[model samples]
Target: MNGNRFGRLFQVTTYGESHGEAMGVTVSGCPAGLELSEEDIQGDLDRRKPGQSMITTSRGEPDEVTINSGVQDGYTTGTPIGMVIQNKDARSGKYEPYVTAPRPSHGDFTYSAKFGTRNWGGGGRSSARETVNWVAAGAIAKKILATQDIEVKAHVNQIGDIEAPEVTWEEILEHSEENEVRCAHPETAEEMRDRIDEYQKEGDSIGGSIYFEARGVPRGLGAPRFDSFSARLGQAMMSVPAATSFEFGLGKEARQWTGKDRNEDWEFDENGDPTPVGNKHGGIQGGITTGQPIYGEVTLHAPTSIPKKQTTVDWETGEEKEIQVVGRHDPVLPPRGVPVVESMLQLTILDYMLLAGRINPDRLDGQVGEYQTDYHPRSPDNMKE
Candidate 1:
């Protein structure tokens, strides 16, 4: 498709379909010589890969990545980085019945209408399966951001009606991975897991919001008008399949407060640098970073594929019919989408960093002194040069 690419300087063009032989991405504009390997990309793929847990789709694909180009000696070559993952588990037969019927609240009908044809198998190009490319590219972006001390993280904030409490960054890093749902709070994550189990049993699906947080982001990362930081983030997030809602900073809740309550008072940090006492703005002000942690949320709708029978009109027959979407699908999307959200955030922020000139594209061209080996990418220690 013409729109398969994302970003300008650091562009990623994805190809292949859900049921195709493979899906992969070509990431261009990455600077050369930063340490990279298939394993770096595989870690994020493992998180987004399906069939990982009972709550996700049963489609079993290791989502193993092969770096066919753009690297030499475990470092990038600054050319287009090519990577692929085989669609080993696609069952095209399961979707044959819906080829003409189309699924509700999905791209099936729209894609058919637009293209005069569609890949009915696993929703083809429209499937979340396509997101593997984004995650793979994002893994590289994460490595780039790591050099500049930027860290992106995301967690399931809401699952159906279960909402998590506001948590510190430390808490998120500490407890988010402790449970299947990836909610930061242990108790709430358990509740979410139980609820997902309930939905799995009912053959229904659930949806919820994911909170994205980026720490150590440098200021002035976005252009003033068209390339506003939040706007870019919104576009990246909304491009996600089934993403229905987006909120930045205080988000919807900010509407309830007056100017006095919403304003962040200017103060000084330990270094005597001016900073905001509170971050109601969620980091970006006037389309640029405020040197504060960027926080936002994306809300995804329940998956379109479900065991519950749905009534749809067959395009060829022009007759109404009930169809059961029998295929591997997530009962709840937020948990599985956490990595996707984080990946999108990484790509967005990394692109803006490139655009804003906060980082040099040639920073990774050689032996770089900015690299930190001991601290994890998300650690506060990594934030310090």
Candidate 2:
């Protein structure tokens, strides 16, 4: 409950359960005068919503977003922006069987142990559905970042054992959304879709990783040590439900590399600015941004809820039971997770920009307490001079 909020300056607080009335969020610290509409947020929600394709859950929620407050004349008012997405297709009856038994590798047990009781309907606040609120808030952040020329994007790069070949930014923009798998490589996406179909038929699930990148982020947006750019980004990526691992440039692979091999040499750019020759550090050096692209991957474990029979104990009866998690659920995660990853990237970058004072928290125009010479008329006496 206390951890529902994220960020220091640009704060985002979410509420509601997965199967409850609706999921909502209050986004504070957004500067006034920025253009925002429900449509801007709905596009991202559409990508993350369930029932997107043959591989996703069958729940038919439209995931339409409604902006409840904090806008007038189509611009943010610098107040808390309230938005909500109602749960139209949540079926509580299917989850009743596992209410006491708890699902394997899920937060059901821990939530019960800590809260003494839980909603138990579609996993409540512990559900990945909560990310709907995240993607909503991230849409606003992305809009704000766009004003500063920052861009965030992601693609499903790995599905189970099948991995797509490395792709350029242009390829991701063009091909990532052309298929169901959200992989940038078309052939690899087909293979990934087939693999997901195999798992769905078997009533099992698979895991994969998403590659995300942020470009046009200014340098010196983060601090050293605990507040490093990479540190905050890691926290953002790891917070995604089912995410098991996170890595940046070189990442774990850096273990096999010597200091000399991993090190990136610096040189002066044509504009006379210092720049790294290579991006082995993923655009960060000494925990701060270096004006290069920030790129990384987040690995999500297989979705735990599956129709395949799994054993668990019924806490209410104090007896063992075999449970088949019969319900609409995704056979794999990365396809739906691509947008979530991009959202997190945008949110993290915007928060850091606000913290670094690179962006004015009061307004997007960055003109605070300054005279509006263009709007104000000079006195008649002064005009004679």
Candidate 3:
């Protein structure tokens, strides 16, 4: 309950249950005068919504977003931007069986133990549905970042044991959405789709990883140590439901690398600014941005809810029971998670940029290279009477 909010200057607070009335979020600290509308957010929501394809859950929720406040005449008012997405297809009846028995590897048991009682309907706040609010807030951040030419994107790179080859940024932006798997590589996406189909037919689930990147992020946008850029990004990626692992450049593979082999030498850019010769550090060094493309991967565990029978104890009856988690569920997650990962990256980058004073917090004055001086107050002597 207390941990629903995220970010420092640009904060987002979310509310609602998976099977309750609707999911909502209030985004604070956004500058006034930026163009915004429900349509701007609905696109990202549509990607994360259930019932997208054969690999995803069949629930028919539209995930349409409605901006309830903080805008006037198609622009933000710099207040808390309130948005909501109603749960049109939530079926709580299917979850009733696990109310007491709990689902394996699901949050039902832990939530009950922590809160003493829980909504127990579609796992309540523990459901992946809560991310709808995040994607909505992230859309605003994406728009804000876009004003500065910052772009964030992600692709499903690994599904179960199948992995896609390295792809260019243009390929990621182009072909990632062309298939059901959201993988940039077309052939690999087909294989991933078939693998998901196999799992769906078996009533099982599989895990996968998403590769995310942020370009045009300015340097000096992060503090050191606890507030490092990578630290905040790791927290953001790990916060996604079902996310099991997170890694950046070299990441786990760095263990096998020698310091000399892994180190990136620096040189002067054409602008006479220092630049790393290579990006083995993943656009960050000493916990701060390096003016390179920030890239990483987030690995999500398989969805726990499946029709395959699993055993658990019924706390209410104090007896064991066999449960088939019969309900609409995604056999794999990375396809739907592509947008979520991109959103988290956008939110994190925007927050850091705001914190570093790279962007004007009150409003964009519609001028290039005037962010710091446009709205500044004049001296008392210079003020008109």
Candidate 3: Cα lDDT at 221: 80
lDDT string for model 3 (82-128, tens) is 99899998889988888889899998889899889999888899999
Q: Count the backbone clashes (under 3 Å) in each candidate.
A: 0, 0, 0
TM-score of each: 0.93, 0.95, 0.95
The lDDT of each candidate is 0.88, 0.91, 0.90
In candidate 1, which residue pairs clash?
A: none
- Lowest-sum lDDT 10-residue window in model 3: 370-379
Question: Which tens-of-lDDT digit does each residue in 14-100 have in candidate 1?
Answer: 998999999989999898767789999999999989988989888889999999998876767678899999989888998888888
Question: Roughly what TM-score does model 3 have, to 2 decimal places?
Answer: 0.95
Top TM-score model? 2
* Candidate 1 clash figure, as a count: 0
Off by over 4 Å in 3: 366-385
What CA RMSD would you report for each candidate? 5.8, 3.8, 4.3
Best first by TM-score, ranked: 2, 3, 1
Error of 2 at 336 (Å): 0.6
